[model samples]
Target: MKQYLQSGIVGFSLTVVALLMPVNGIAQSIGSDKNTLPDIGVVASEALTVDKEMLIGDAIMRQMRGQAPIIDDPILSEYIQDLGNRLVLQAENTKFPFEFFVINNSAMNAFAFYGGHVGVHSGIITSADSESELASVLAHEVTHVTQRHLARRALSQQRSSPLQIASMLGSILLAAANPEAGMAALQTSSAISQQMTIDYTRSNEQEADRIGIDILYNAGFDPRAAATFFGKMAEEYRLRSRPPERLLTHPLTEKRIADARSRMARYPEVRLPPSLTFHLAKARLLARYQFDPDYALEHYMAVNEQGNYLVKEAARYGLAIALLANDKAAQAQEINNELLKRDPNNLFYIDLATDILIALNQPQTAVEMLEKEIFNKPRNSVVVLNLANTYLTMKQYSKTIELLRDYLLVKPHDQLAYSLLSEAYKSEKSYKGMHQSKAELLALYGAYPNAIDELQHAYNYTGDDHLEKQRIRARIQQLRDAEEKLRNF
Candidate 1:
């Protein structure tokens, strides 16, 4: 089977890969005027249509699922998606739906792929001092997609072989995943190729920054955050021999920092209040994703005792999560209860409370609370997944299956749902359903052969049901065709 690169590499890095050929478009004057932003809209679709871009993006995303250390936390995933959508709403020429996710890496990097997929490292969230700083990075990535920079770069490389294009993109992704191996693979390419890629990316970088700042401002974030974030990254890594992956993909020049500050000056200064959700999300990362549970607990406890955090509630929230991680379930429940009492409707608190409740062996209480959330926010991934998990704990296999089947209809790409559904099916002794669900889970990871084998297993359990067998056969063929198409692409 042919494997593509991990998806969600930096927007500029992907565009840089496309720099395998010549870049089009005249370099617009960056300082043309403070009032009017340049219109770098979508280029010609004849070279690479939206459909093709989506297909390529999906292929890369599948490969990424197989290879990348994707964070599977629904709460964090939901938070990032909501944040990205806020910017997407203000963005122009948005031709596709947007999906945002987080990677479980400590290195500071963020990336966007052909489809509306954007991913940020957990490190970025932990490092960001404010939500706007995080939003600023996201806004830039969103602009890359809205402006169709990747498609434009591909358009310029229309004469190149598809495999060559894929290889370039894959090498960058490999570098992101394994720097030494990836750098070796990249060095095999010509030095001239690397130079051209950098030279062209500079212009696109300018455009993305200019447009992204506007998106950030329009979305009601601090526009100066763009400048502040850029300056911060540059200064932090200034004396280092090796910069962060973000600085590598998005080369931070002194001029870029100055330009961001100059452009941000055009917007009116507004002081926004502290975002509790952002802090909570960051705390979640620190407590659970970043450090050892014991260390995280001590860190949060110190923050709480010292009272030296951006948000006091967020500090306590972090402590609660750490307590849970350390298996102090009773203490965690007490903390969560207090937090919930204050913010009765906050999903972050509620999600954690649900976990705490479940851990306390109060499945019925957890079910009741989550059921209410489901009623209020039907089809909400966070609530639904939590509820499904609660059902599994309660050994309500049939209910778990029913709930997940409905949930999957809405979120078909959710690997977590498929995994849960597969377990529920197995627990309920529905062998065919178990195999079928497992097949989809494998497919998401781009394991086409294994997924096909799973379907065949499911087919064997069909017990001569002609219609079911026919459907299985058709599904198997579809997987085969999809795999074949990906090989060529």
Candidate 2:
């Protein structure tokens, strides 16, 4: 339970879902500036419930990652999914599925996207001094999600927008396209709805702290870990001879950590589960996929001094990932085998084994492994995408279309997913599929830069529009012209 945090709220995408308060005096907080449910209230909280929160969160996730997440690596994806699901089940509302992840960034922070999307910086994994310490962070974010703090914050601010959810969904992509611009926009938009950003009162902080401990204890995890992580951050502050700036949001200090310890003093420590080992194992893997392996190797060994099997697995995965990235396939393969021996049923190991086979010029074997992965992860878009890529490699265009079409059913709004689906359709002479897919693409991404370009693309490929298309097209040209004039000035 040791840690360090940066001044800025580490964001996964430019748009972070946050809850703001109507208090101008507290327009900002540490590790908070993201658009959270707390920042954007449910507008209709009289009937708000956990199920509804999950639905909204899922919708936000779909908008942020699209239906089929772009997971180039299956081993890494499945592992993180499993790890996230484990903690999600332990939170207050098990009905709400929480998806945890290591975003591909080097920022030293972690944050939760409203809905079940909890993200940690690739750097956080490498920085964790102990595996349980990481669990403490996940528990804190889970508290945010299960508590519906985002919606609460929104209601408090009295923020209202006609577009509501659509604007919220668009916020993520805005972050993706330009994080700074999106963050600025978020700040401005929030100010209109609330005061700006509300630094939670000490009472609010204490409540989150209490609930966070309850979550940790109930999840069968050590409550003390929460205190330890904060303690570590406090220590970091002393090391620098200055209080960590993130303290503005998190309010960290030995006093806060001691306070947290007192809150959990009555609770007995629970052994973290076997699943957490898998979580740390995968966190280590994903961190490598997201960061520099050399740095990862040094970090892994340091964090896993406990030599717990799972933490060691994390280091091993980190080491293999580095070797593979450096073109040392032979060495990577050896590590894969070692991992397989430890966890033969592990989805990640199975997938990694296949990746190694594919890299070693064993196409036929790779196909078999990928086909199995697809069958196992039937609902996962990235799994299907990988299988589709494998088909493309084998020159099976029809098979590619079949796989991509299935993927589009789950994630039609993703530009890359749609583009690939369009290519597959075009290759198979499925003109109807190709035309419909293109129009869908234009509608989503067309709203960016200039709407006219997207409208024109839709008009050319938008086969049959019965309503809304022409009206939308007209509005697009007008907006495009307006945008151009604004740019000229």
**Candidate 1 stretches greater than 4 Å from native:** 1-44, 179-200
- For residues 107-155, what per-residue lDDT tens digits would candidate 1 score against the true structure? 7778786667787888888989999999999988877676666666666
Error of 1 at 392 (Å): 0.7
Off by over 4 Å in 2: 1-81, 88-101, 113-117, 129-131, 162-180, 183-196, 241-246, 273-290, 293-310, 373-377, 380-383, 407-489
Clashes of 1: 0
Query: Compared with the true structure, what per-residue lDDT tens digits does model 2 show for residues 77-137?
Result: 4555665565565543244456665555543455564556776655555555555566667
Q: What is the C-alpha local distance difference test score of candidate 1?
A: 0.77
Q: How many steric overlaps does candidate 2 have?
A: 25
Location of the lowest summed lDDT over 10 successive residues in candidate 2: 21-30
Model 1, residue 49: distance off in Å is: 1.1
* TM-score of each predicted structure versus truth: 0.89, 0.68
